[model samples]
Target: MPRIRKNPTGVDPQLLVKDAAKLMPAPTRRLFLRGGASLGALAFLTGCDIVDSASAEHVLMKISYFNDRAQAWLFNPNKLAPTYPDSAVRRPFPFNAYYPEEDAPEVDKEDYKLEVGGMVDNKKSWTLDELYALPQETQITRLICVEGWSAIGKWTGTPLREFLRRVGADTRAKYVWFRCAEGYSTSIDMPTALHPQTQMTFKFDGEILPRKYGFPMKVRMPTKLGFKNPKHVMEMAVTDKYLGGYWEDQGYNWFSGI
Candidate 1:
């Protein structure tokens, strides 16, 4: 996504609300919008087990009401998990590129290409259709952003392991690193790469990724934090050695386990 000056969700309250919100249960909505009614009830029920009832109540209520009622949610148990109920996570159709403004970068070609190489025998560049031609896998995953909000999304794409195998990756390829268009990057171990649910994701919410979410292509690390999911992916390489990824060099742990 281009770095637009205005807020991406939009300035209009209704439009902003629509873009950010996932439809949640009516009671949960009421409890949240009505401000402390439901939160108070939950606190009363769980207070005995909590460290400090008053402090706990403040935190619980805060998560649900903290942000614009849409955009994303939280449910970090280590923190206060603000979850969107399962029903709210339903996908109506595929996601699309969300350009923040009219001047955002336009995808110019039909064959957006991806380069797969490094420590593999069959280094090659694949066009969008070529990638789609590969065996595809689909999974619903949780998009956990670092800012403390999350959303569950259904994604369809080819498995990275499949790609590795096709490219003839050496057994010693212990980790994979990605370079994305957003000037952001991430890396993961081979074990995480081979996990059944992982993907070299192509489609999201049944649609292509939005720019703010990394249009064209983005890495989706379901069991990991959002920063690990690099958007606007350009290249990937398998390595036996640990070359610290983009985030790691900045101060984050290379092994950012979820």
Candidate 2:
């Protein structure tokens, strides 16, 4: 039997457990609550005595990793996210980012080029016109944010799978990593990268994507929470490496599928 140590002075063990639960993404939290998991159970499962915040954090991170794997395994690659009509699209879509809207990167479209690398046969950089020339599709899907707000918006872009095929990307690669002009970065599993609803978005609301909404280009994934959809995308790489994202590195789940 695993030994459970008493928590430090003034620290409520129950509160610690509740705090850990709150750190989990919504779906994971629901599953955790449904299972009736508790601090003692977590310590027993991890074989670690949670005597302090450090130990508690260690245990919670392990559970988070487990949740990530479970979500990824259960993800249905073929299932499409629900789409709405233009009438359902939110007017003046809310602008969101880590920084203020005025601070958004101002990308000059004429000089912008998307640099592609890694396991793709064509490591060529593509210009705006070139990307726009690709077969484009539009979807009015809900953008679910981890912060709990959601908005329906129309996005138009090349289907990511089609773009990957055009670039001769290795479909078997483990992950597709992206770099944004605003110093944000994120990665997604190959399955998510190939999802039909995942797009390399160039237009929003039938207009060239505005600076406030990731001008030039954004990797839009209706299947993922808003943070996972990188805007102002400048570069991408297909690789087997696990390049963690900005939020993910800070303890947010890596496989944040919705």
Candidate 3:
């Protein structure tokens, strides 16, 4: 069976191109078009959309034509499509080739429970049962990515703030550090870290957070870049120093926001 699709989000390329073109002079626009065509054809050949971002801008514009006709072009939505009541959000087609590999969160999920440690009076590991026993919260929120796509979905889980409060975040605690199953990790500030909309999601669209979609848990923040939403979270640490994120180290903005 095919892996079920999950978490679709992206930006409207044509609109992005249009916006980009409007910024450049007419002569520059022509150059960008030819370059875009060459890049687009290469992407088609290589099965890569970002083979050349500078050149593919025009091609993305052309793709946007069909996407627009499909009424699926995304950026900021004037209105979101009716939530499926349908369950199972389809994963967006990824055009970039930076696929990161990690151990699946499902195989030994309980084997690596979330450890709450650092600058805390009570350092502990939380089991699924323990997290479930906390007062649960459900919310429908939009996932906006730095690449420009957006999607809305339902999430149910314990609020990060609530979890920290329950575990007793110390006065010195200024950041929440998240360590994932892949040995990958990231951190967030206190405010965004504890945002009302942020959650250690248990369910997506009324179902478990599937393996491909970060089974055990992932961070969901309304105010930051999607990359900040790390997956397969297994550890939460309250700290003071700036624990820069994976993407941030790669020249991407740490404060990736709208």
Q: Which lDDT values do the candidates have, in the order given?
A: 0.59, 0.84, 0.61
Candidate 2 ranges beyond 4 A from true positions: 1-51
For model 3 the local lDDT of residue 89 reads 44
lDDT for 255 (candidate 3)? 50
| TM-score on alpha carbons, each prediction | 0.59, 0.81, 0.61
The runs of at least 3 residues in candidate 3 whose Cα sits more than 4 Å from the true structure, single-residue gaps closed, are 1-107
Give one clash count per candidate, in the order shown: 12, 0, 4
Instruction: List model 2 lDDT by residue over 180-248, tens digit each.
Output: 876789999999999999999999999999988988899999999999999989899999999989778
Kindly report which residue stretches of model 1 are placed more than 4 angstroms away from their true locations once superposed.
1-86, 90-107
The best candidate in terms of TM-score: 2
Candidates arranged by lDDT, highest first: 2, 3, 1
The digit string of per-residue lDDT tens for model 3 on 1-258 reads 112232121233333344234344434533434455776788798898765455565565556445433432232323322333334443441222123222233435445567888877778788767876878777666666666777666767877878878888874466788876655577876766666767888776667777656766777766555678877777888999768666454334555544
RMSD of each: 11.7, 11.2, 13.0
Better of 1 and 2 by TM-score: 2
